[model samples]
Target: MNIASKIFNSHSKEDGDFFLAMTRILGFKPRKLGVYKKAFLHRSVNKRDKKGNPLNYERLEFLGDAMLGTIISKHLYTEVPAGDEGYLTKMRSKIVSRKHLNELGKDLNLIEHVESKIPKAHFGDNIHGNVFEALIGAIYLDRGYTYCEKFIHDRVIVPYVDIEQLEGKVISYKSLVIEWCQKQKYSFEYEVYEDTGNDPVKHFGVKLYINGKVMAKARATSKKKAEEKASKRAFYALQDRISKN
Candidate 1:
């Protein structure tokens, strides 16, 4: 059977019902249901389109990232007239951060619809944000910018956006720790080393030191994550001093 036939055979009216429910949640009806299906298709499936291009959400996720940033930036610009460029950018970053997007994706239970060869449990937290971005890409391709904007407003802005709360939000503990150290004129270092463990995934360990004293140590699958974990511990350890200075 051809791709069209296979798609039609695999998806029934019940599937459409489920998609319609998703559309209601997204506030937009997708014109090409196949696009949305592709949006949920994971890279592990190893599927390809007619042109021999990989059919997964990664490319769509990139598009959605830009779209989301644009919409959020516009909202921040209009909402805060007195705010400067840096302030608006930072606020937008906090709102559309990967962590926040992942949470939003999980809150919507998007993983239930994911089509992947890999076990769902094995997927990392970023999968949620990836699906969310793919959803935006599908909406943009199906209905265009107006519908896309509406969907973002309904699903993203109206429900979750709070200027005051976002202002206080921290996008990265690592950045915070670095800033605090710089402000206090204290020398700090993150000594990253390979972790020897039996885990399938290679892990990186980080020892965060401040002013020649060991502050915290952490390990994670990635160096950035390990550093962030260490920085978080360091932050709490020096929270009193940080607040004072």
Candidate 2:
């Protein structure tokens, strides 16, 4: 009933700090702190349970991803009664897009609580989204689906879901180019190779070919990013014709 009682009931001072941190983030006290604790644990620590099974946030991330998709789907279904299947699916993808999730995680400063042996700066951008999803997983485990849904609605949808703005958002330019190529009955290819540039990070170079003609070229730190960058350039180059589709 009281703060001291709540702390004594679950865990001591450490959990006390976690409790306050979670309260600030979730606007409510967590019933079970174990799940929440595991949610932020990175695999680098190599911890195992009594049964020798590995412990980390990855499994929780999977559960939270499913939960997030379900809640977002429900909201989209209710908000746009006239939306067809394709429209609704696209809308949901935009809402749960990795870029948006990363932004949400950063807003909550979720990384500050992560228990990783590696320096926080070295962690990839996806860490933010991963921990956020893990947090959702913990909420579901601790409080069940109702609370999980409430948390998503309160923290995610209510503040951020603007249907009009999201409709125009670009989740992946590569997908757009492929879709256009398909509709036009044109063949396309992405030739990716290791970048020879002097950049410190290993870079990838991509050349986008549409109808057997080189349309655009780009380089990035990853093949996917390089391809996407090339595709984005290709999209703009053919925007006039593509928009007619």
Best model per TM-score: 2
Candidate 1 residue lDDT tens string, 2-29: 4344545788865666566566556554
Highest-scoring model, lDDT? 2
Candidate 2 residue lDDT tens string, 1-245 = 99846796767788888887887788778878889989999999888999999999999999999999999999999999999999999989988889989977876788989999999999999999999999999999999999999999987997568685577777678999999999999999999999857543356899999999999999865677678779878988898665787
lDDT of each: 0.82, 0.87
Pairs that collide in candidate 1 are none
Q: What is the lDDT of candidate 2?
A: 0.87
Residue 54 C-alpha lDDT in model 2: 97
Poorest 10 consecutive residues by lDDT, candidate 1: 1-10
Cα RMSD of all models vs. native, in order, equals 11.6, 11.8
